[model samples]
Target: MAHIVILGAGIGGMPMAYEMRALARAEDKITVISNNPKFHFVPSNPWVAVDWRKRDDIEIEIAPVLAKKKIDFIGVGAKRLHPEKNQVELDDGRTVDYDYLVIATGPKLAFDEIEGLGPKGHTQSICHVDHAVEAEKGWQDFVKNPGHVVVGAVQGASCYGPAYEYAMIMDTDLRKRKIRDKVPMTFVTAEPYIGHLGLGGVGDSKGLLESVMRDRHIKWICNAKTTKVEAGKMYVTEHNEDGTPKKEHVLDFKFSMMLPAFKGIDAVFGIEGLTNPRGFILIDPQQRNPKFKNIYAVGVCVAIPPVEATPVPTGAPKTGYMIESMVTATAHNIRDELDGKQPSTKATWNAVCLADFGDTGACFVALPQIPPRNVNWFSQGKWVHLAKIAFEKYFMRKMKAGTSEPLFEKMVMNALGIMKLKDK
Candidate 1:
């Protein structure tokens, strides 16, 4: 029996397991190793930070879930990967051998790079369930005495959606508490513009987001580079369009949240040719490693070039829907390879997202993955918010059941107008 070893149990890893099951033979065995026993819905993490949701409500035990599907599970952390030897070294000094390996170890937070920020001094983040839980506690303390609020991403950070999401959620929460007037809010990011979103502005995104933020009275600073963060204050310098220098100022905050830069998980980074200079995996168009035929990567773990050279420093975020597409494509290729068939190359990923603003939400859709052919559209309404909630429920339920249908996938793709078919 051929054994398949999968590392990490996040959005990218788990799906590959189910997809591989669909492709592999009865004699083949599937095993999953994750640092945590539970999987947390990362998108809902913003809600958890604002007390809108609880830890239990957003997470599930991965061991039970995977066991129900008959996949062997190892709830342990991966220490390193030996692609040449085809073995995964566990931190416990144990090893797991595999015929095929899927490296879905998602990005790790680089909080140490930034000074006086993160879990150490002040500033909150919605990066993980634990972080969100701790941030929620901080929010409770802030509500007792309303003060300054700053929400955005740090330089070189991808995953920008949550930063905007957190800002609006905080705005809404304060308004709900009738303390909006007590808090001075600001939106800061490394994106060059109000709506770049790492993929550049999707159709009407610039107008829609800019207009909405103005209406919400949320001050913003784009193309801004953060230097250091002191207690209750942050130092930042803005970059003019030409990458020239600009003066700096001290922005103080009583409560703040900033997304941290991400690096490849330590386990996979040790292997040669598996990652880029910044510590993210290097995968070809098919999301397969060029150096190791049996190894593949997807999700935030995969490396992509910076969208542009900005003095402030920034990188494109591979959104959730895009990551899902990568996993789906890899699953198909791996199954084909196991059957002694040639694998199809990975398809390019586009973006489909909903920006929930608490009272309402905004929708965005972009195509082609990269630039040259980009159309981003944004609209504000209560329905968008309701739609996002419905989608979240649908995803959790579907994941719990362990199946996502092809028909449903087609329907979603067509609805988003993201994928262009060759015509039936």
Candidate 2:
């Protein structure tokens, strides 16, 4: 029996496990290794930062769900990925052997890259639920005596949705707490504009998001590189579009959370040809590693060439939909690999987002994240917000319930309707 080991339990990992199970016979072992025993809905994490959602509100135990599918679920962190040896070392001194391996560990926050930019003791993050809880506590502490707040994404950062979502959620929450005016906020980011979003501003996103940020009275420092973060303050340098450094200074913040640039998780830090120089695994359009055909990567863990290299560096935003597509493709290809047949399909990149603006939201759909492609973006009212809320709830329930179907396929297609509307 062929053994399939999937690393991680995030968006890409969970779905892959179920898909592989469906492909293999009962004796073919399919096991999932993850650090998090309880899966937290990542997209909704921004809501948790501002106390809009509670810790228990968004978490579900992943073990039982995988077990129900007859897949072996191991709740242990992967320490080392020995791709050459065809084994993975767990944190508990155990090893797993596999004929096929799918790496979907998501990403590792490179907080230490900027000196003192992370939760050393006082700051908080919504990247994970634990971080969100800490951020909630920080917000509560700030509510007692609201002061200057700095919310933003750091330099070399790729994922932009969380930063945008967190900024608005904080604003909304502060308004709810009746202290919106008390906290002067600054959104600092590596992007040159309000909505560059790493895909270089998805179809007029710059103007629309800028207007939104302006309407909210949220001040911003763009093309800013975070140098260091201390208690209640963060250091930054504003750069020209040429990426040449110009001005630098420290901004005092009462409460702050900055999204860090991502690199591949530590487990596969130095696997030859498996990863690029920047720690992201190198994969073909099919999301399979060239040197290791049995190995595949999906989600933030894989590397995609940058659309443009600016003076201020920007990486592509691999959102939920992109990751979902990649994992789905991986699932199908693995199925083909096991059957000794050629893969029928390869995943391509498509960008779609329903970015929430707290009270309202915007929908962005693009054929290619880079230039030379079709694009459509539209902004609407509270209906968008409600739609987003419904989506979050539905996806949360569906993820916990363990969907065997490829759901994002429908989402990607439905988003195409809005894309058509944006053109009109």
Candidate 3:
């Protein structure tokens, strides 16, 4: 009887548990370990910050849902990852042994890299639901006395989409409140250009996003290094293509939201041969650590290098579809190992993103997330925004239903000619 232990119950881990169950034997025990009891839709965090969504609207208690599928649950977070023994030390003074372990704990926000940079500091964040809620409070107080606003990703930040989303969402929200004119907005990012998005400008994204920002009247600073953030003031240096400082600015703002750089969670950090210097799990194409065959990883926890170098360093994004593909591939490979076969499945690493801009948005499809891709497309419209809303509802329902590959999702993706895995 094999016991499969999955750490983290977020977007990648939950579906991975369900998919493992679908592919595993009846006697194989499957368990999910998470720090939080509830599952929150991370994509809707920007809306929460703007008070367009309440906590309950985007979050659901996941224990009951996982229980319905006969999967054991542990809310106590992982204290240590003993890959050598194939056991996980839980925070509640317990250890769980596993025949196969999947780590999907996601990224640890690296806010300490810069002074006065995070929720506890001078700015607000929407990375977590709780942080977004706090940002909502900050938003409320700021709108009362509108001034300049700064929103973007800092140096070494990987998740650029949300920064873009929040900036546009706040703009849209302020316009609705009829006070947009009172507030000037500036976008500061680590990417060399407006739409590098860590995938090397997906289908003229540079041009499209620049045009969109111009239309929206939001100024921007790219290749920006945030030296420090003080109360109501941000010190920034914009770098030239040759990696030289070209411009410097000290911007003042009544409200700010800057996405922090990401590093691996502490549980697996410094694990020799198991992780990269940044502490992200080191996985081969099969999604299995080369040195630790029994261990696998998915989602933001995996190490993927930057597609190309930039003036200011940036990393590739592990998009929702790409992470889902990794989850599916890992589950299949674990099943293969159990059946006494060499692991073969590999995640496609495709990128499908729908970035909301309040009432309108941009959508992109990168066949392969790296450069020299086959199919790279980017488009924008209100329908994309509606699609994002539909996706949020659909995904929440999927988690509740414990359905990894829902029929409706397949149909929609098929209709759009999107492929999660490459054709064999």
**Best model per lDDT:** 3
lDDT of 2 by residue, 113-191 (tens): 8888677644577788888888888778888998888888888888887888888878887787788989888999888
lDDT of 3 by residue, 167-285 (tens): 99999999999999999999999999999998898888999999999988999999999999999999999999998999999999999999999999999999999999999999999
| Candidate 1 lDDT tens digits, 12-74 | 777777777766788889999999988888888998999888999877788777777788889
Q: What C-alpha lDDT values do all the predictions have?
A: 0.80, 0.82, 0.91
| Candidate 3: count of backbone clashes, pairs at least 3 residues apart or interchain | 0
Candidate order, TM-score descending: 3, 2, 1
Sorted on lDDT, highest at the top, how do the candidates line up?
3, 2, 1
| All-Cα superposition RMSD per candidate | 2.9, 1.6, 2.9
* TM-score of every candidate: 0.95, 0.96, 0.97
Better of 2 and 3 by lDDT: 3
Best by TM-score: 3
- Runs with alpha carbons beyond 4 Å of true place in candidate 2: 418-424
Angstrom error of the Cα, residue 355, model 1: value is: 1.8
